[model samples]
Structure formats: structure tokens, C-alpha cells
Target: MTGSHGLAAAQKGVQDSGNPTHFNFFRSALRGRQRVLWCANDPTVCLDREKNPWGGSTCCYQRFCKDTMSDPNHCGACGKTCAYGFVCCNGNCVDIQNDARNCGACFEECPGQSRCFYAMCDYGG
Candidate 1:
């Protein structure tokens, strides 16, 4: 079977393992096919191998895997929130403050005719 198909079949047969973050999939051989084993809570096995094979990166938080380095909601660490007008910049939450690109708020860019200053959208030329 194709990888996606196999993943779908495995997911369909998943069994909860008491822990909210843990799951197990057991699939018996069908028509002489080999058995399949899937572990949801294993970062190396499930996340690194299956979910993020290329990136091979993940962080667990509240029963979910996250990329704390860039995720604004969990920047640097889980539950480390960024304010509405701020963003996760290199693992730290930061507001516009002095950024011309995100003037006054996250993703709020200053117009070409103006410059950003003191967290305001428009300022001196």
C-alpha cells in the first residue's frame, strides 16, 4: 500500500493508551501483508519519522507537538504567550517597538512614504 494509505489505515485502527498524548495502532496482516505498528507519543518514531521526516523537529506541549521556536502562541516555550500586537522573533516575543516592517503591531507594515518610530505606524520620512 502507499504510504498515505498505510497511514490512513493505521490511524483508523489506533487505540488509546490511557494517556491523552499516547496512542497505539495495531494492524493485523491482511492477505499476507505484514503487521503495522504505530506509536503516537513517540517523537522519534511518530513525529520525526512520519510527521516531520524532513524537519525532524518537534516539541511536546499539552499532549501536542509544536515548534516553539517560531510558533507565536507558544514562542520559546509552551504556554509562553505573545501579546496580540507582538510576534515570535527568533524564539522571543516582540512588539513592533522599533521594527519598520511591523510598525505598531504584528504584520502591520509602515507605508513607504513614512517610517516607523516608537511603535507607531507612521513617523518621520
Candidate 2:
């Protein structure tokens, strides 16, 4: 009954208290009720648009994964980070896009004198 939404319900319950059943229902409803934002989703693990920790409040939720594009600690997804000497590229960490050590993928290693370019190992060179 403290919140704005609860006010109306509380007033309605008071008006209907003449009925025994309605009074009992309203009395029980006040026991375990608290204000909560239904659209906040999972506030325990998500951040709002203003980079503030969400506590199920109706503030902002659009910037939840937006930091993943530039954040090394969350490059592609939450808690995903780029390894040493690797840079995030389209959600994956790659090295130079042509490095012999990590040619195409992080685990891909070029053999012999092949020069990697654009994720392709050019053995012709």
C-alpha cells in the first residue's frame, strides 16, 4: 500500500471491507507485498543503460550488452575477454587477422612459410 500502484488497491480494499471475504483478502494481501519493477528482468546480474547496477528499478536496460563491443573484459559477451596479444573481432579474439601463430582462429597456427592475410594462410607466398 506504500507504492503508487498499491494505493489504488488499498483504497479499493478499504471501501470493500464491509464484506467479510473482501476484508480478509485485503488483510492477507498486505502481508507479503513489495514494490518491484516487472520489466527490470534479472536485476541481480544485469546493468542498466546508465551503467548502474540494476536492482529491478525502472531506469534503463538497453545498454546491458552494449559494452561488449569495446570492453576487453566482455568483448563479445559478458565475462568474455580477449587473450594476451589478441584483439576482439566481431565477438572473437583474433591476432592480426594474418599472424602465423593465430591465422584464422585463436588456435590455428600456420605451417612452413605461409603468410596469413585476412584469416587465410597464403601458402603460395
Candidate 3:
């Protein structure tokens, strides 16, 4: 049997020769026999590290497999985006709000002897 989701099922059991009991058993088993094959070519299919030879696990996003952990366009989840000038860090967008290297803005670093506080560069002690 074949499914629209690219799944194929096949019978898996001992073949019947001429025994009546075996034939009956096989016939009964056949009704509940099914094996599904997971195809790698399917873009909508999600695979784990063991099933996927590329690397780690991946999810289906926009008809493609994406690792949301680092993808800026799909950080943390599918269709999740990072703002402009923000960098994807461990599935979260960084470089904004109290970040010293991007104080008040993207890449707007704090000056010497100063730090970022509340999204602004503070130069006081």
C-alpha cells in the first residue's frame, strides 16, 4: 500500500506453502501486517540524528529541512525570525537590549570604561 505522505507498506511474515493452519495464520496476520518506509528525499519529513546522515536532527520548514537552533531565519522554531542587526545565538536572537557590544543598537559598542545598561551605554562608576 502507498500513502500520499510518501509512505509505503509491505507485508512482513512467513510465506504460506500448503499447510492449512499456516495459511490461515498467514492470512490473519496479513490483515494487520504493515511496514512503513521513511524516505530521506521527502523534504517534509523530519529526521533525527540517527536517521539523518547529514548531522543533527532537523525540522520541516517551508518545505525544507532546517536546524532552528542556529538558523537566523527560523531561530528556535519554524518561521521564527531574528531582527535586523541581531544575531542568532543558541536559537535566540542576541545583540540587543543591554548587550555591551550592541548597546542601544546593533554593533553600537560601549566606549572605554563604560558598559551597557538598559540598552544604553553607561559611562559612570
Candidate 4:
């Protein structure tokens, strides 16, 4: 959990209402009187804590991965972004910047890695 993408902001301690164990996922954003909505038994995304230069929170979090409730690869997970650049393929995280289906966004190729073709290997298409 020490990668560059780890949820460092969430390290601050906070009150865990009812289910205390699972509140860590969003504890960082709910600080300083910020109201939060706990969906289901636990939630990964709380309220917006990042204020723009204009001092306003984006109420909607298209960029915040934790807000995608139905995205299996990202849901209930904080700061854990889908690798392959945000495409879901066969329940696997794919970086669309080079994935076959999302060649640029849906399909991307990892550096020095070949596409899995017919149990064979090739540099790239």
C-alpha cells in the first residue's frame, strides 16, 4: 500500500459510525464537518474534499475512481485504479491506452509485452 497510487490522504483518523472497520476507505474526505453518505453497509467514496481553485468541490466525481459504484474493478476500492487505463475486460483490469478492444483507451499494449495470440506471441499489431 506504499505505491505512488496509495490512498495517503485517507491515513488521517476519523469517527467510524456503526461499522468502524470499513470507514477507512473514505475517512480522509469526510473530515472537517463534511457530511458523508454511506451506501450499503460500507462505502468507498465519501464526499468531495478536493476544492478547486475557486474553492468549490466537484459534487460529481467522474475522475475520482471511488465514486464508480458499479465498476467492479474500482468499486469499494479506494485509490486503486484499473490498470489498462479504465476498461473492464473479462473481469480483468485493462489499460485501454493499448488494449486490443480499446487500442488507445479500450485496448493498449504494455511496453515490451506481446499480445496473447493463439497461444503464440508477437510484438504488436
Candidate 3 residue-wise lDDT, 17-107, digit = tens: 3445666787668854522224447754556555554334356665556666666787777689899866666677776666887676556
The weakest ten consecutive residues by lDDT in model 2 span 52-61
User: What global local distance difference test value does model 1 have?
Assistant: 0.59
**TM-score for each prediction?**
0.42, 0.29, 0.41, 0.23
- Best-performing candidate as measured by TM-score: 1
The TM-score measured for candidate 4 stands at 0.23
> Model 4 residue 110 lDDT?
35
lDDT of each: 0.59, 0.57, 0.62, 0.40
Top lDDT prediction, candidate number: 3
Lowest summed lDDT across 10 adjacent residues in model 3 is found at 5-14
- Encode model 2's per-residue lDDT on 1-125: one tens digit a residue: 57988999987776767666765776668743432233345543434435333322222234332344444566666677688867765556667577877787655777887788877798456
* lDDT over C-alpha atoms for residue 43 of model 2: 42
User: Residue 110 of model 1: what lDDT?
Assistant: 77
Ranking by lDDT: 3, 1, 2, 4
The candidate with the higher lDDT, 1 or 4, is 1
lDDT of 4: 0.40
lDDT comparison, 2 vs 4, better candidate? 2
